[model samples]
Target: QMQGALEQHLARLNELLASRGDYVQTLKFTQQLAGSIVLQLQGLPAWRGVSADLTELSGQVAYVEYYRWLAYLLFFILVLTVCLLACLGLAKHSRCLLLLMLCCGLLMLVLSWASMAVDTAAAVGTSDFCVAPDKFIMNQTDDEISAEVVHYYLYCDQSLSSPFQQALTVFQRSLTTMQIQMQGLIQYALPLFPTAEKDLLGVQQLLNSSETGLHQLTALLDCRGLHKDYLDGLIGICYDGVEGLLYLGLFSLLAA
Candidate 1:
């Protein structure tokens, strides 16, 4: 749950930050509005640094996954070879093959113990995380996302209010106000300063786009989405990850 929630939040945060480009363009357009009415644009948080970090993390995950698959494949082959050698030795009554089979069986036994140890550690760690996933995620993402936002998603209870509601309200009001102002300017001011018509229309368009973005942002910030992701992640980790490890441990025991 913690891993899933963190990943979902990071992905949303990245998307929110990426929208800064449109905000920047809006700021530029707002500068032109300064001639008629003063409009102060709030600065967006820096996203490039966070984006770079996420990109690096993605690369590392891919690398790790590739190696994990390779390791599983190699282990499977090793077990199959051992089984084949045992069969060959028994059928042929060959001393050399039997000796080799003995050596492989000893190796398999050591490896099974090592694998069991690893599986135990992994299961323990996962159980620990499952106990207080929210706290773990909060600690991990303290530097990246706000505690209020994190809490809102971690415990998506009906009574809990959205952390972004106020911000979204303000954003909606601001967009409506801007759109009204732009419409008035286009209607009245265009007749007086015909040359400003192009800029006025552009600003109106930008305001519309911003309003759409605000709606999208509100949806993304909703707790249901992130909470669902968290639940799914928990299911995967608990049901699939741990179960698979147990199966592997069983196989190891059988091989030994």
Candidate 2:
């Protein structure tokens, strides 16, 4: 009986020794895992504030900005036209043409100013699209680049806008609408071969495209006055191209 008890005690001692070894090994591994996790968490960066300043920037956001500036230019042109009219008004020159020119210029100027006021909404709205890295956590590509733009052109345009970039979105929606109108004109002409309707439609399209292109170009340059000659030359070309389309469509319809 004594020998049997001794054997049982030895068996229990061996089990305890094996369990203690395993516990020591497991504890060591757990400590390493916990320490690694702590280190990794420590390496992570904290949040930084995102920001934007309108006056300090000019890029994609500048497109809308330039539109605003153009109104100011229209104002300048209006003033020049006004001065010309006033000089002629005093000179007793062909008062009719002067008056007409003056009226047109003044009207255009007023419209431009009004449009400028409205476009401010566009500029303010773009602020939403502005991605401040801290506030917005996006893949680097999406935050800094517009994948749609051929160049992934750093949409350097400061969109630093409101919650949803509402104004910016609405402004873009308008551009998209203009695009749709342009598309509709083309589609309308497709079924009709050289008809008057088709001719008119094509002419209108050319004009629309020309105008949109001109607006885009002027907007692209942020109205810095650096590309006046380029814009002027392009405008003349686009105008002639549109007029030419009108004439061509007219002649084609006449022949048909």
Candidate 3:
């Protein structure tokens, strides 16, 4: 009977050791999975950073656009004032009005030449931008974004597929793969751990929001619309202003 009891005691001890081993392995697996999920979740912050940068750029461009429009408006008023003065000088046959008209005409002519000179210089500067806007923009950016990525969006051709699109595709694919892994870990690999499930669900939400932001960033980075606006500003301030002022000066001379 003592031998039978000793045999039972050994059996119980073996079972206990086996159970402990299984519990330790399970804990190790859980720790590893939790660490991986946390790492994957951290990637979402990059999306936030890109979004903020793009938005700030858009705002700055718009502010400059407002100033461009104001300059055009002031130029228009100046031209109108010169024309009205010339007309009054002719109608009233007044020497003072005529002198004023002559002075205004000279002023306009000088301004026209100055505008042309300034615009020419600006065009020379802008030519560099037209050639490689990405390089110009890179000078303004921080190290958070790589130069290669900026060039990918700026220099990419519309006739071909965009690198930004490819990046988004790959980004989404990676997120999907990681989410699948996390889901598997939570469901099959760690069902008994409700805390892991909560963490994984939070990660999934972050990834989902980041995916939405990525789509918006793709649209924002197109650069075509921004380029078009820049071209319009150049034409308005440089070409149109010069031509209008030249015509006004000629008309004033004819009146004299």
TM-score of each candidate structure, all chains considered together: 0.75, 0.27, 0.50
Per-residue lDDT tens digits for candidate 1, residues 1-256, read 3223323433443343344454334434433443222122232223366558768987997898698679768777888998999999999999999999999888877887787777778777877887887798889777877787778778898797776666566566666765765676566555755655555566566667667776787786678987998889888877787788787767766766
Q: Could you tell me the lDDT of residue 243 within candidate 2? A: 52
TM-score: which candidate is best? 1
Best by lDDT: 1
Structure candidate 1, residue pairs in collision? none
lDDT values, one for every candidate: 0.67, 0.43, 0.57
**lDDT for model 3:** 0.57
Q: Arrange candidates by TM-score, highest first: which order?
A: 1, 3, 2
Total clashing pairs in model 1:
0
Regions of candidate 2 where Cα sits further than 4 Å from its true position: 1-60, 112-256
Candidate 2's error at 49, in angstroms?
Answer: 14
